[model samples]
Target: MTSFGIATAPQQVEYADVLRVWREADEVPEIEHAWLFDHLLPIAGDPDGPIFEGWTLLSALAARTRRLRLGLLVTSNRFRPPAMLAKIATTVDAVSGGRLDFGIGVGSRPSHPLARREYAAHGLPFHDTGRATDSLDEALTVIERLWTEDAPFDFHGEYVHLDGAYGNPKPARRPPIMIGGRARATLRVVAKHADLWNIPGGDLADCVARSRMLDDYCAEIGRDPAAITRSLHLGVSYDAPEATREAIDAAVAAGFSHIVLGLPAPWPGGVARWVADELVNRSPAHRGT
Candidate 1:
């Protein structure tokens, strides 16, 4: 059965909104998880907006929530070094008692000058698709090494090189790696790395076509397509329970097993209750992890 999670926008300044959603997730039996956008600023280009940094929020959430799994919908590979990020993920996994779903990806806003400016300020490389994918490939390798390797080793790669690479604590368990994107290179990375593939462009026919394409990529790499869970990230209204259920049903029909909804802001408590009470249980989709 299709699972449901809420992906809250960070651009909005409501600290209450983030807490509210987690609170609802705690109260609702159907919400499998909750996510945050990993952006530094509002995508709407508002510089003054209060975009709570995702990792910090995630850390606090790890300490706060008991049942809801937490993570970024797709954190950019450009922001932090993968080795450092691995430590962060491991720490969160421990704090959350092994409920972290590590979702990551290439950048989302390629043309935003503000983002580019920030990248430059941080000394992070903002390369073209090929270079970025190369870096991500290397980053995933490093991240996995840090999580899995007990002995110190050397990580020599095209983008990042480290001597005596080691990561401790190893996450209560290695969290599931979720990679999101639809680019040819991105899909290749997803096929090679992701435990859950969050497909972009969430139309039914488009999702079906893309899933088939992803299956081909998996086969090319000698992987079982079913080994990776299929997820669709979308902006579906929870303002009405019936409408939301309709959207979820459609996604499931298109072969998406996990559904992450980006709810509209101005948090509606009543709508949330509707989902908790009326919709999620009514759906035949399997209860998600």
Candidate 2:
């Protein structure tokens, strides 16, 4: 049997109100995990537009919900230092009673002046794929060591170094590490280290092909393909007046353990409710298998 889950863009609505409603909604027995998106600025539209910090909001959600596991669909490595990110994740996992998974990626924000400005502020050199991926790999190594090692661990990487450093009060459970991206390098990293892989926007056949590719990579690396969980991000529009159950079923047939649907827009009334009902509730047994 499989399970079903939902991932949403961060609450752009009034923070307090959205938190209240999300806390309640997450209590529903059918919802397995409540996911948030990681973006320093809006991926679309104006950069000045309202956008909540993903990790901060997830930390708050950890306190507000009891059962729902919290995580980012994919966090970028360019945003913060690996040690700091590891600390934040550890804190959230402890706060959530060991129910946090750290999903990260090497992707950047969509093209926009404001987005570029924000990236510059973070000292990130956007459009440099090598730099971005190198940073991501180093960050992953640091965070994983922080989560698993008890004694002071020393890391000497090109981008990061630690000299007998220790993370106090480690996460109650070592949060699972998830890496996402369709690039060949990304897939190789997934085969080497990821607990889960999030593949974005593809048809069923595409998904199966990607899954097989990942399996082949894993086998070549002497890793078990079954050890990694596979997930998909499905963009859904509730206003379409028709559910995309066929696509969802196709994803399942391709061995996706989780399908994350993106809501068209955040409206506090019937539209949001309709999306929750028609999309997330379409299948309850296809997640976390």
Candidate 3:
């Protein structure tokens, strides 16, 4: 089934406003998933606005909604240590009744001003993507082992080191781990590890091209390309909702099974309703059998 979901940009909205969106979603049975971004602050524009923490917001939302699968689009590995992150995902998944999608990324763009500000605020030394990806390799290693292993173990890596690590209360179900990226190095990580590969903001042909590149990586790694679900994050216009319909159809045609519709915060008037009535109806999974 082609699963469609909402991935909200929370920079412009407050806690209460976002809650309304979640409640609106609760009223719409067709909407399959609900998501947020793991941004310490806004990705762009004025960084002075209120930016809610992704995991905390998700934990709160978990208590409010039942059906919509929850996740951040791509959480940076630098935000939290690897072992802790795995435990957090485990706890949230248990609380949400196995509805978590563990979306993670290497890190944010080193050149981005907001990212730089965020790093400075958190006292995490900023590094280029190369170093970030290396750390991410180690981080994912720890996360997966902790999530699945039955006994305590030690993790030794260049960037991360741990001993007697145990992720208790293992999730009732294993949530799909989505690695989000576009570059070749990141794609290799996705090929080797990701349960779902999410590529954010790209045209149709670009997505097809990237998918092929990921396929190449899978082949080189002696892995099946089909093992990983391909997901696309597309910016949508609720005003011209037809454009969204076309984009969703095009993305599905291009071999993306999971479609994440990204909406600007302070939602455009009637957008949520339009999504429920129009966009969700486009999904065969949402339609009548």
Candidate 4:
């Protein structure tokens, strides 16, 4: 059975409002996961717009919701050091009773001023895509080792390094590590390290093709393709004439185990209600009464 999830643009709404909406959604049986977008600055044209820190908000969400799994839709590798990021994730997992999923990708919001500043601050080779991919590979290794190993795992890579560093109180559950991106280098990283794959900016056929590639890579590496969960990040607009119910049905049929509905800009109150009614209420699997 397909699991339906929600991905909200928290920066567009107040933190209190987001917490309320998430709590309500958690009570709704249809919703399985609640995702938040991560960006150093607003992705839209507003440089002075309000933006909440992704990790901090997620840590709060972990405490507020009971049944819903929480995570960033995708975190930028440029935002924090890999070891620190892993530690933060572990703490969030412990607080949430092991309901966290770590979704990560190479930087995407370079157009934002703060994001550009972050790139500069880190001295990240943003101009060189190859260098960025290499950095991501190193970061992924550090994150995974931190979560799994009790003894300090020494990692000496081109971009990241660790020497007899210890990570304690591992997560109650080994929260799934999801890698996002459709590019070849990104997919290779997913094949090598990710327990889940989140595909964005693609149609069903494109997603299917990418899924096949992931499976092929898994086979090449002697890993089981079925072990990796496949998901899609959908840009959903309630105003569209297309029925939301049909859209969800199509998504499930297309093999998306998780559907992360992208909130429209300017978080309209009715959008959440509409999703609860038209999508969650109408679904036979989640109708409360």
Candidate 5:
């Protein structure tokens, strides 16, 4: 069966506004998960507008809401050391009663000038795509080892090196890893590591093509393609509910079983129920299921 979730980017919005939506989503059975994005500065309107840090805000949201699985839509692997991220995620898992889904990826691409500026503004190094992807591969390796390894260990990778790294009081559960990206190198990592693979939805044909490429990569690695859930992140249109429903139907038809509806800011009151009634319930995928 298909699962549906909502993403409220922590950009240009107040914290209480987000809390309200998540609390409502918690009571709605149709919405199984919720997310915030990993961005330090505004990526949308009013570049100087306030935005909350993703992981910190997520912890607060996790504590506030009881039912929804929560995490950043996809964390920027560049923002924190893998071992540090492992510790943070474990804490969230405990706080949420084991409902964390760890989503991560290489940071914003070099081409996105708006997203790129945050790196410099925050004194974070923004490497080229090749280097960034390689780093992500290494980061995931280090993170998983920290989560599962019994003893403190050291890792010497090209991008990250750790000395006596360990994660204590392991997560309530090892959160399922979800990696989001479309690059082939990223896809190879997804095939090898991710429990779920996510791509932003726009053109249906391109989305399916990327999914097929992932399948081929899985074959090369001798991993079952079906082992990884296909997740699509599609933008939600409060004004055009039918259009959003149509997009959801097309995505579900293309074999995306995990749908994350991206709700833009100035979130309407009762948005979670609004989503269930207008988008999730109205979509043919949900109706027939």
Candidate 6:
């Protein structure tokens, strides 16, 4: 069955509005999970628009909601050291009673000028995709060890180095890892580490091709391709429900089972239930309901 989720990017949106939508979604069985993005600056709207920090906002949302599993859509490995991120994720997992899906990836690429500016604004070094992917590979290794290892350990990687690293109170349960990206290098990492792999929806053929590459990578590693859930992030259309439903149908038909509807900001009242009825229920996957 296809599981549905909602992603509310914090850019140009009010905290109360996001909270309200999440609270409503918590009561709706159709929406099983929720997500926030990790950009420090507004990628959309005015340059000076207010944008909340993703992990901090996620922690607050975790405390306020009961049923929804939540996490950032994809945390930037460049933003924080892996050890610190692991600790932060552990706290959120404990707060949400072990309902975190740890989504992470290489930070925004240099190709996106808007996204690129934020790194300079925040005094973060924006490395090339090669270096970024290398860092992400190391970050995942360090994060996993921190989450599951019994004793404090040291890691000395090219990008991340840890000395006597340990998580005192681990997550209520270790959260599943969700890695988002469509690049081949990222897919290699996804095949080895991720419990779920996510890519933005638009080019169905491109996404299927990427999935196939991931399958080949998995096979090379002697791991089952089915081990990772294929996830898609399709933008929700407030005015065109049929378009969103068509995208959902196409994604599920291509073997993508985990769907995340990206809701636009300044969310309308009762938007979660609206999404459930207008998009999810109307999709071919939910026909005969």
List TM-score per model, in order.
0.91, 0.89, 0.94, 0.88, 0.98, 0.98
lDDT of each: 0.79, 0.74, 0.84, 0.77, 0.92, 0.92
For model 4, the run of ten residues with the poorest summed lDDT = 280-289
lDDT of 5: 0.92
Error of 2 at 118 (Å): 2.7
Give lDDT tens digits, candidate 3, residues 3-116: 878878777678888888877876776668888888887776677877888998988888888878888888889889999999889988987889999999987887677776
**Regions more than 4 Å wrong, model 1:** 111-123, 238-241, 284-289
Supply the TM-score for candidate 4: 0.88
Model 3 whole-model lDDT (C-alpha atoms): 0.84
Better of 1 and 2 by lDDT: 1
> Stretches of candidate 6 above 4 Å error?
none
Alpha-carbon RMSD, each predicted model: 2.4, 2.8, 1.9, 3.0, 0.8, 1.1
Q: Could you tell me how far off, in angstroms, the CA of residue 50 lies in candidate 4 after the best superposition?
A: 0.3
Tens digit of per-residue lDDT, candidate 2, span 224-256: 999999988877755553446666766777788
Clashing pairs for model 4 are none
TM-score, model 3 to reference: 0.94
Reference-based lDDT, residue 170, model 6: 80
- The global Cα lDDT (0 to 1) of model 2 is 0.74
Q: Could you tell me the TM-score of candidate 1? A: 0.91
Tell me the TM-score of model 6.
Answer: 0.98
